[model samples]
Target: MPEHLRALIVIVILATAVFSLAGKTATQLIPARDFKRRRNLWFALTLLAFLTHSFWLYAAAATFCLLLTRRQEHTPLALFFLLLFVMPPATVQIPGFGLINYLIKLDHPRLLALVILLPAFFTLRRQPGVIRFGRLWPDRLLLAYLLLVALLYLRETTLTDSLRQSLYLLIDVLLPYYVASRGLRQLQDFRDALLAFTLAAMVLALIGLFEYARHWLLYRALLGALDIEWGLMGYLGRGGSLRAVATAGQAIVLGYILAVAIGFYLFLQGVTTSRLQRWLGGLLLAAGLFVPLSRGPWIGAAIMLATFIASGRHALKRLFLLTMAGLLSLPLLMIIPGGQKLLDLLPFIGSVEKENITYRERLIDNSLIVIERNPWLGSVDYRKTPEMQSMIQGQGIVDVVNTYLGVALEVGLVGLMLFTAFFVTILQGIRQALRRLPRHQNEARNLGRALLATLCGVLVIIFTVSSISIIPVVYWSVAGIAVAYVQWVRLQTQPHATLDR
Candidate 1:
């Protein structure tokens, strides 16, 4: 057989395997009783797909499972959480194109989430009176922001590029928010989503530990073989020690996700009936936060941990126990092999801080200059701006690392205000819920407090990095969930009163 023909045959086989895996996973998502007759066939297909070692196949299978289960009460929320949590950090580029020729990645998962959300939209359309639009200031603000983005699209030099970005904003940010607010109807659904997130975080934490210790990324090489480069997969620090990216594209994002998980688990520890599960989950998430060696997220996590300690019952006792545990473990930690290395992994633990501080300062200085030129309506594509291009050529500054600055650069001061207002409304809503709930409702209050702290941490972390990834979608989804929870609380508190529409 010709070599070209053999290669084509191999590609066909791989594609078939991937589709089979997706079908099987979808079948598995159906209840056992519903799909009992097809179980053996799906099992065999899943086994075959696993043996093929195709990362894309596995990712598709996971997505299909979520899609198939969307009708279940808890599944939509679970699907949104998993889509953000389980993204593979790989990038694919068009052959013979320049550096900026990279294809859109990670957007597919968002697309999948949007697809799962379609039925929810249809259900709402069928029930006209059920789709209440009152007291949704956050949703209004989000819609305003999307409109601002559309207006900016008109000013873009490349219409196609701007359209694509607008689509991403719709699917990744707006759609997730819509799904969370509508699909997660109760506090129990939110808890189930958080549980799923925590479990996924635990697994990522273990993978990060392995990567840190061995200096080998888990799936990077496999991605590389398929011509998909993992962005910032590994970083060298502390004289060549590896900084773990985990499944997040970069260390800072991973740290941010872990910090949020830690905050949630801390709240869970206070309210959950199972003590062992809470403690174990919290410890695993804490370790996960430490492994990333990213300072911004460490600061965020510290703020969140402080909030947790300050609000919990018997705070002083818990603080004393935590302090004593650290003191008691110090000597033992020092004696163990690679213990110092582990300590070094924590932000500010060793001599690996000065470089990052200097780099961020330079980035901020450059971004401020760019923002000054386009203050009201930002440069739709900063790279295309002559001044920015000149600056890059003159000074080696290529990208804005700050999320706020990146937003200001892409949209404008107006966009920034709209974005900021969206979060402000969410925080205000949660606060209102907290105030209205009775003091005896510990679980509800705990959840509200936890979400507030999580948002606080997210706000802090975003200042240090351009969070133009699936992470922002997760953040917005949680905000939507908070808004939904607050709305539910309001309805329960005022059973007879009609909410203003």
Candidate 2:
């Protein structure tokens, strides 16, 4: 808000764009180390600029471009980026002051349209590439989902929310599938798309981390200005120290993403050479996860760890690593003064944990209450919830913490039922993939395991977080990739089984 700060942010944005252009282009031409350094500089600048939340859009756009260009080797990277964006959400936040706040806000839609849709637009323009639409694994279900959401929206009070929901499905989910189905019909294309996505995430995360730190410095400076009268609003605006959630919305989303990265790395580790190298890679990923200490991600991390420990053959190594890491971080966790301070929230957490809690319980309770009054299909409105609006007006605002419940609250029972089916079908896909994996194919098996772990992690986070706006991008992107992988695997196993043949 301050003139100096605003100038600082604008300068940071320009600097970032320059670094991005240079780094991305140079990485193509120069040494890998040099490329990483250039990207690191861009990241550092982005972090410095996060205080104003301006450069984030630029970062997101830059990332989308970088990946779109480097289409060759990025699936693992894309999955990693997806995880990074998932937890430690991509919203703004300052630290160690004020309300100890959390907010679920997405980046601007216009930028998103430019970043995501433009590529599809270009693809569409070049040639008439048709999708052999056979009620595909996800496509069939996605349409059903669209229809159900539309119905709920048609009857809803908040027309704008419905519009966004439809837009998210059409753009994020459908566009990617449409583009990928044509673009990634081949096995290599599938891998390339995923890798490109991963690279994009790393680029953005590095920048987000950079700007996150910059915002922290600014927050500390502001806190210093406040001196004795510490404020909550400023810190809440910036997010906490664990990670500087940039365009991804929240640090939890960021953490979840980092966890997903870990999952990918674990998959890679199972196949990569040298045990020591694998250990280092795993450590690097775990360190990445800790940057955003969101509880949802913590839960997600636990899920990932459990999966690793139960991965049968690989259990010993992963469990050993986790055991060692836990034993070590425990001392640090205990000695930290702030770690214990969080105990004060035990009552609130416990209250929320109760069979009938506040945010979680309230949504379920309200929805059921509404349903009871009008059981036959239930009342629906396109307008914002009057009850929620009052609360928002009273204390800014928040969402139904649970993602599934949030949808229910937004669209009522029918929407909830359909969404539940959509998710269940996705999980079913994962299960089928896991079962169908060839016994001797380590790469496919490990990859499938990693995907399964990530899906589980995401599911856990959604249960406790209102990640609606993010789900289409987050879930659907992976769903598309999963579809690609399945097609790829089936082709690899039984090569001549194509419709074209």
Residue 453 displacement in candidate 2 (angstroms) = 1.0
Q: Which structure among the candidates has the greatest TM-score?
A: 1
Regions of candidate 2 where Cα sits further than 4 Å from its true position:
1-131, 156-168, 180-234, 237-243, 270-281, 308-358, 374-394, 468-471, 499-501
Return model 1's CA RMSD, one decimal.
7.3
Over the full model, what C-alpha lDDT does candidate 1 score relative to the true structure? 0.63
User: Residue 321 lDDT in model 1?
Assistant: 84
Over the full model, what C-alpha lDDT does candidate 2 score relative to the true structure?
A: 0.51
lDDT of each: 0.63, 0.51
For candidate 2, the TM-score is 0.65
Worst 10 residues of 1 by lDDT: 33-42
